[model samples]
Target: MYCPFCSHIEDKVIDSRLSKEGDVIRRRRECFNCKQRFTTYERVGEIFPMVIKKDGRRERFNREKIFNGMKRACEKRPVSIDVLETVVGDIEKKIQEIGESEIPSHIIGKELMNQLQKLDHVAYVRFASVYKEFKDISEFMSEIKSLAPQSVVSYEQNPSKTIDGVPL
Candidate 1:
């Protein structure tokens, strides 16, 4: 393996371990020249379905995109990196189980929203606002109402109540 630090072509594996799920292998390597150590992960490459975009374009399935979207939504929230990683894994497994040559992008988005809704309400709304493209405050408020009907009802009953100091 090439060493990332010096771009050396030679490296020695110092240690190797399998992931708890047994789906990935982690390797600790040291550069032969600089002796710098780095870790690398290995996983079996599986064929994934092409994503049919909304614009009628087809693209290769990208795992990073999903992770980044979730990460951005969960930012400043109480969710952990491990939980997000597991959610991504679950989504990947679901896609693989579909076993189709092509899949619609909306399916992936809906699955992500479902997972986020169960994980964190704030994160779910954050993702939904962008994914669903709310055009006005009413649309945004409608989504919040659907997410927590009881809270919305209580706010409606109490006109004095405000969210972030703004009357709801």
Candidate 2:
């Protein structure tokens, strides 16, 4: 291993641990030259399917993109980072289990939306807005309505009330 502090190639592993899922290994390393410590993660480089975009372009599957999108959707919400990480991990596992050389982007998007919907309604709508590309307020309302029929009915009855800080 290379030392991050001094770019030295020699390092000693101080500790090593497996992730909860047992799919990743974390190692703590100390540089021999600078005596600096850093952590590194190791995981099997499994082959993933290429994502087929809306425009018919194929690109390598990116885990970071999914995590970032979910992060943005859950921003300022009560959701925790651990929950988001688990969600991303679940999606990645599902994709791998599909065992396809190429998969439609919509499948991934729908799965993410489904996961977020169970996590937080506000986050689900936030993600759906972008993923589904709502053209107007009605389209957005339709999604919210589908999430909670009682809440939508109450909002219709009382327009002054707000759902997730948004006025009806």
Candidate 3:
């Protein structure tokens, strides 16, 4: 590696250590010319796929957006940031494994919904309301009922209340 101190092309690694997760390498190097010591970290660069929007627009994949969306969904809920981070990481890794240069935005949305549904029902509904853009009360109720089928049973028990005569 090139030495930053004297711009020398030669350097000796004094020590090397792996990061906690083993995804990074920390190296202590000494410049052969200037004898200066420096630390460097090496990591595998990730090439993320492009996000093809609903309107045909494309943009680089951003993990922060995923984290923010999950955070918003899980707000005031029992879910933790670490869980959200893992979900985001899993989605990112899955996309990367596909080896495609572009991925549909709807697919990403579906993945988020799938993970959130398993994580928390209330949070899933909160996210679905925004993601699916519920236009009417019936749509929201339908989603909530589908999310929790027990609600369907309870609503069935009350035959007086009818959702378009289907009894919810």
Candidate 4:
């Protein structure tokens, strides 16, 4: 690494440490020529996969875009920022686990809808209204209705009940 003090190309690493989660390396280095010390962080290059849109356009995957869409859907809702961040992280992890360099936009939308549906009904309806392109009230109502439980045998039998139909 080049030294900031004397612009020397030679440097010795005085200390090295792994950051939280071990995704990056933190290194403290000393310039050989100026005796100045500096810290640097090294991380693996993130090769984001490409997203294929429904309109046949290809673009790089962006976390900001996903977060913005989620934020809009979550507006006027009780969802917390931490929850949103975790959802994003989980989505990214799933996409990476697939090991494919390209994925359809609709697939990502489906994943988002699944997450929003579990997070908040209002947010789920809001997100689905846009993602599913509801042409009328009937479609919207049907989407929401599917989320409601028709009958629960007994609250005691169903020890775990959740708003999104998931067993808590």
Instruction: State the TM-score for model 2.
Output: 0.63
| lDDT for residue 114 in candidate 2, whole number 0-100 | 64
Worst 10-residue stretch by lDDT in candidate 3? Answer: 159-168
Q: Give the per-residue lDDT of model 2 (tens digit) for 1-168.
A: 788889999876655555666456576878989999999997633446788999999886776689899999999999998788778877876787777788888888877976887799999999999998899999999888887867646645785653323232
Q: What lDDT would candidate 4 get against the real structure?
A: 0.73
Tell me the RMSD of model 2 versus the true structure.
12.9
lDDT of 3 by residue, 17-89 (tens): 5566645656687898999999988662344667899999988676667878999999999998767766776
Alpha-carbon TM-score of each model against the true structure: 0.63, 0.63, 0.62, 0.62
Compared with the true structure, model 4 gives a TM-score of 0.62
Q: What is the per-residue lDDT of model 4 for residues 12-95, given as tens digits with 9 covering 90 to 100?
A: 665555556645656688898989999988652343457899998988676667888998999979988767877876776677
- Each candidate's lDDT (Cα)? 0.79, 0.78, 0.76, 0.73
Clashing pairs in 1: none
